[model samples]
Target: MSTFGKLFRVTTFGESHCKGVGAIIDGAPPGMELTENDIQPQLTRRRPGQSKLTTPRDEKDKVTILSGTEYGITLGTPIGLQVPNLDQRPHDYGEMDIYPRPSHADWTYLQKYGLKASSGGGRASARETIGRVAGGAIAQKYLKLTNNVEIVAFVSSVGKVAMPFVHELEDEEPVSAEFYDMLNNISQEEVDKDITRCPHPETAEKMKETIMQKSAEKDSIGGTVTCVIRNCPVGLGEPCFDKLEAVMAHAMLSIPATKGFEFGSGFQGTKIPGHLHNDAFVRKEDGTLGTKTNNSGGVQGGITNGENIYFRVAFKPAATISKDQETASYDGAWGTLAAKGRHDPCVAPRAVPIVEAMAALVIMDSFLQQQARKASAALLPSVEIHHSLLGVPPKK
Candidate 1:
């Protein structure tokens, strides 16, 4: 279950308080330029102790490339990556050994496995995403080098503080041109300028204030991260059960604390009339068809349409807040449970890279699957169909 993807398989290991956590990436194309440097930036961005808005758990989150590279080139073997749990304090969670934290995985994990990690949330911690971020960084590199694809995610809303554009959209209204323009041009640098990572300066300020208020209350607040994948190749998703958006939703919701996922027009499209909601196609200057309105979110009938793929992921507030709560223990004994340990009051800012990484994983896996189909089809001889209904015109 720790593994994800098909051709570009990644298996993540370790736990929140384990010796270390990382991923092993298999099926990476051989001879691509790779090194620890290529993967560290994303990990750094995802790591704790970044700012006052985030957990103060001091961790370098420095990655080490253990194998699968020679002279900075991939060897087509499994690439190994790891980041140690240097600042982890297993003692901080000592009290949780009895009562499970409310809304956390502590109880379910025990029910499923009959036992659980004594410290931290075990595999349920956001620390599990370190491996995902590292693995996604490599997938991102391949996507960037091959197709010039770019994935950017930013905190769009924190608690009730959302960007004016996002909160103001009517039920039947399509995303505005200004929103599209922002999606087309926003970069990680701009997102990183503010601790809240909302990209919009004014919204980021409000989000920061909201997070601070929640942290002060020893409670937490939930928010959303919006991600866009630009320059995605056409025809990446499967036709039926494995729709592009379906797999993307799987990937996004797999991250800890995620509560919801939506892409393109998403729920908004349901409120619009079919005539107005449809994305009418228009031929581009490049001779390929493009949609005038992207209400389809760059995908139609489970396949990509060579447009920017965008989506929003909602992350529930961090569960392990340092506040007292009324909850029952493993044996149904009710008691007050006050959790300890460093945790984010709001997870959307830190979740940005994780969202980008998961998006890359989905896109990379889909692209590789599409590429395999094309390669295999290229090897087969072409057959001329002569049926009146199905026959194609003869080659010019």
Candidate 2:
């Protein structure tokens, strides 16, 4: 199924070179103020031709809200959004219809579906994610209004030019207007400027130089993005069935060209013994129990523990490049193929927003689940409410 989540489900559609792509969001809370403008910024961040590190495909990625919204507010119904695929170069992909790109989903989709859509990987294209991003924008807004939860993700590694010390990224709020401006305002013409999308000036410059050199060689590189979730409340997961981490991993891996994913203490946790790796609980100044360390990544037993949750995602270099490579045609005849497309030599930069989008979708679904549980719990006859509290409290 192309849909995900029990509540707040999202269904994505459209193809890479098609007229347009879009998503249908079901279960969004009604009456929330929504508009095309609210979702456009996220799409703009993910669109092509916006920077030097990504493809030069000059897509406006302009989105339209077709349904589920009225009078600039969500009707609490399914939100249907569309992103027209401008700057599509179907002619460039004409020959590719018969020849599958190695390491792409072409051959796999053919094997699974008996035939494949020919234009630019059809449904498998990263273009399909425009819808996800649009839908995710709505989810992001809900998280902020309901829980003050904030999610942020950034490119931390680009091939050899990895950003220093992932630990340096503390749990922070989602990007503000200033942060977005900082990202876009940086001149790509300043070839000596930053790379890897790291906020640090020197490293960004090195990363940019490396990408330019590699793109000149018609090759590509891979890297990672780390996402942080802050102010996530407790009890936002379903244990033994759909664990939060399990769902999050699935969502992250669904993005095209994603190679690996790991959350707090992931593989690195194995390097230390329990004594060092364990997150010791401590009382915080806020009068809440907090972990001295976040080895658990803010989730324990498939539920949030009111701490920062973070994870890293690795993306392989864009497979479609100008570099010549060996492959076969649809007839299984051997041949060499050099891709022709306005492809990104490195995808890490644009992927930052996508990572945050997916994280928001996942967390938003969990947030809704948490709310439903609370609403259900409050119906009990003996439930005691504290006059000082704004929400339902545990039974006394």
Candidate 3:
């Protein structure tokens, strides 16, 4: 389905080489200030040709607000946004008409629909995410205005070059103080300083070098993006099948070329026993409950705990490389395919905004869902129950 979210539904449309691409965003709060300017910054960040590491698609990605706003204020109706695809070159993908690119969506798309786009990856292209980034800009604005939520994502690793991490044997020790400090204070400006989008200076240089080497060889490399959501409202996710982390994983993995998702301790937690891994409850300066350790990633039992929600998303290398490869055609004929197209050697840098955008969408939807539940529950009369029957510890 093209739509996502229960309360804040978004339906994205258009293909890679289409006339344009955009999204229709429904359920945005009325009377809020909204304009193309609010959404353009993120789109510009996600656009290609920003650096030599990324594809040279040369899209301006200028967005236009078609409706759902009057005098720069949302009217509580569906918001229509569109971005023109100016630099499209369908001829570049002429070779793909016969042979499907390896490790790409080409074969599966053909099998599912019995037809496929003639140029580029069509819907599978990173260009498809333009709508997501646009919609997320609105949601992020609302979240910041209402709850002061802050979402930041940056390239944490490129290929084998990664920031330091605690090993299984070192699980007894918490994540490094430097790592925590970075999460607490990192900003988009700091992240964008380096083209790699890795806040750490040395690591960003190494990642840049790796990407340049891959581009020189007409190859591609993959990496991970780490995102942190701070000041998220408590009780933002369901306690069952729609656990906070579960939906987050679904959202992150939906991006093209994404292969893995993990939050908090994730797989590392498996090595530590329950006692050591459990996040102990503590009272904070705000007189609210908090966690002594954030092994739960600010979410426990499927709900936000008013702490920072952090996660990492892994994206595979760009499948369409300029190098020649041995592969079978649609008719099972063996041949050499020298893929011709503008493609990123390393997608992690470009993926930074996409990751933040998806995280905003997930958190925004969860926040609205919980708000609706609370509003309805508040209408009901209070019920008195025994402390033991409640199955929760008594308040201090």
Candidate 4:
């Protein structure tokens, strides 16, 4: 259960308040230049105390590579990475041991294991995502180097505040050209410009104020993260069970507090008839082919359509609020409790990197799986893996 991916497998370890947490990445391609530096950016973005909207736990989260690389190059072995827990406050969370916080893993974790950590959600904490970010960074590197693929995620909304008309489209209509252009060029640097990471200046300010206001009220709020995968190669997903969008949805929902997942037309498509919802095929100037509209979000029939892959993930508000709320103790006795210790007013701002990392892991794993399938088919010349089918041009 701790492991993710089939070929590019990452087995995560450690708890939130444990000595450390990290992952062991197996099946990464050989001969890629990788080091601790390549992984730290995403970890830094994911770390707490960076903004007023998130938890104020100060952690450097410095990652260390213990194996699987030499002289900056991967040796095709398991890469072991770790980051120690710097700020552990068992005293602050001692109340959780007595009673489970509402809408948290405290109760269920205790019930299932008959045991629990003295502080935090232990393995259930968002801190556990450090390994995923690190491993996803590696995968992102591979994907970028090989295929020019780029993945970026940003806070789309917070509480009642959302990006202007982010979901304003009708079910029958295709995505707007403005959104396509905006997402096509949106970068992590641009998203990092504001604390809320909404990209739009006015909406970002509103989101920040909402978060700060909620924090002042000793409450919490939920939000959404929109992610885009630009220039993804085609024919990466396996149909039936392992569709590209399906794997992506699974990866996203696995993140802490993620409540919903949608891509392209998503739920909105159900409102319109299939005729108008369909994306018509169009030819490119380079004699290539692409869809005139990207209502399918660059994926069709469980496979990449060689267009920009975009999606949104919905994250619930942080379960732990400073305000008092009624919840049951371990023995089922109910009482009012005021949550203590550091927690985010809104988790969406910090979750931006997590969303990007998870998406990267999915794309990278899909790419490797496609590569393996191609190599296996090399014995039969009659079975040709086409450019449109595989999203890779024939090598000269």
Which predicted model would earn the best lDDT? 1
The per-model lDDT (C-alpha) reads 0.91, 0.80, 0.90, 0.90
Q: For every model shown, what is its TM-score relative to the native structure?
A: 0.96, 0.89, 0.96, 0.95
- Model 3 TM-score relative to the real fold: 0.96
lDDT of 1 by residue, 42-125 (tens): 999999999999999999999999999999999999999999999989999877887989899998999899999999989999
Candidate 2 overall lDDT versus native: 0.80
**Stretches > 4 Å off in candidate 2:** 167-195, 383-396
lDDT agreement of model 1 with the native: 0.91
Least accurate 10 contiguous residues by lDDT in model 3: 166-175
In terms of lDDT, the poorest run of 10 residues in model 2 is 168-177
lDDT tens digits, residue span 1-396, model 4: 899999999889999888999999999988999988999988999999988778999989999999999999999999999999998886899788778889999878887898888788888899899999999999999999999999999988887787865775653464667788888899999999998888999998888889999999999999999999998998899999999999999999999999999989777767788888899999989888999888899999999989999999999989989998988788788888898989999999899999999999999899999999999877776865578787667778
In angstroms, how far off is 92's CA in candidate 2? 0.3
If both were scored by lDDT, which would come out higher, candidate 1 or candidate 3? 1
Clashing pairs in 3: none
For candidate 4, which ten residues in a row score worst on lDDT? 165-174
